[model samples]
Target: MQDFREAYQSTAVEVQENDIQDNEVELASPWQRIGAVLINSLITMVLYVPLFVGTAMMGDSNGESGVMWIGISAVLLLAWGIYQAILMSKTGQSLGKKLLGIKVVTLEGDNPGFVGTVLLREIVYNIILTVLGMIPFLGVLISIGAAIALLVMIFLDGNNRRTLQDMLAKTLVVKA
Candidate 1:
């Protein structure tokens, strides 16, 4: 047991050093990316269950409950941001990123001075998309376009990773 522990730590140090030696970013595989997304989404869904109920409580067949829905949504988003941020800090990756073997690092400025590129690239862009989705018929078109653009960015990335938001934030989805 003692020998195995030493081996694991030694291996970890070697990998970290190699990352520095490479001089360029090392990214994770695409399958890991999908896994991480699935994991994170499942966690988020469970967290938002009560929030969903609250939103529904304020609505009915007639329509939404107006400001209440908006407030519930805001709280839900805030909760999501905090949760993702905390997870990113501790793991250097969210559940999805961990599954994908990717960690978020800022290639550019942490202009907002937030930890974990996932906070900005994932949480912030989500907000923008959500806000855009609130519009009329145009909102739907914009949402679809934005989603397509994000996917295209990922496809065009060097290793089938890094969506538009990731590129914009100068972050990488790298192997753990």
Candidate 2:
């Protein structure tokens, strides 16, 4: 441990961070991720419910009940995720990430706001994992794959505490 710290000190560059409290400087756990997701979900629901209700009322005024409201809601949710990713990459914090006292950055604490990186990590990778899980019987296989990916992210060895998305995005979550 002493040797590792010495090497890190000699080789690793320290990044100047935000006005983050010293006590908050800890690698976020999976539970923290869950909390962020919950917060983001709540925000999304607030936006969705109103739109759905308004669509229902408009549909009632017409001849038929409009099921397209559900479809629209789905699209809106996807849009929200994209928006969240953009905000997270730009500001280093999503609404939840900010509330939870964590921000995503690179190992060197620089955030690369490349769209390709964002899509690769948030849209392509995660959605692929999720889609596989939707398949019956194949869901176990999908879950195993996703678990492996998540484990790889959580256990980043000595380099940094990051997940697959972090690696792909060259980013990490630290106290903010």
Candidate 3:
């Protein structure tokens, strides 16, 4: 009985050590997160350049060309969103995050999958912000304030470094 107990205790310690090693992750710094966001915003703006150029060249007098441009822009935006979602689901890194050498991962350090990346992190917060911005006189201000609050949370959360979206999605942005 004494020998069996010793064997069990040793095995338990080894399992605990392995678990700790498996779950360990280096969190991305606040600056890295900010840089990634900036890169993403720049990429988004660049993607829309074609629409802007087409609109400028066509000069929609009859509103017909304006509708076409809007359609094209919508398609382009949808494609971009899909591309980002795919990357996030598979690798936990959007284009900007990949470039910045950081990635979003579950608490267990696995890829966040589609629901976490698309629904919780991206769609839900965006919908809330859009609704806030659509309100009356204080709408845009409230939206901007909420965005700032979310950004500030990253700085405040020293241990986990999670923003609101990261909390909601049960994810962390970590060094790749």
lDDT of 1 by residue, 19-73 (tens): 5436565556556666777888787777666567656665666345544665676
Error of 3 at 24 (Å): 2.2
Backbone clashes per model, in order? 4, 2, 0
TM values, all candidates = 0.59, 0.59, 0.77
Candidate 3 C-alpha lDDT tens digits along 33-104: 989889989988877876786677576564666667767877888899899989988998889889989999
Write one digit per residue (lDDT tens) for candidate 2, span 70-143.
Answer: 66677787888778877866877788888988777655555656443366667677787788889999988888
Q: Rate residue 137 of model 2 by lDDT.
A: 92
The better-scoring model by lDDT among 1 and 3 is 3
RMSD of 1: 12.0
lDDT for residue 5 in candidate 1, whole number 0-100: 98
Misplaced by over 4 Å in model 3 are: 1-22, 60-75
Can you list the residue pairs that collide in candidate 3?
Answer: none
CA-lDDT, candidates in order:
0.65, 0.67, 0.81
Q: How close is candidate 3 to the true structure, as a TM-score?
A: 0.77
Ranking by lDDT: 3, 2, 1
| Residue 83 miss distance in model 2 (angstroms) | 3.6
Model 1 gets an lDDT of 0.65
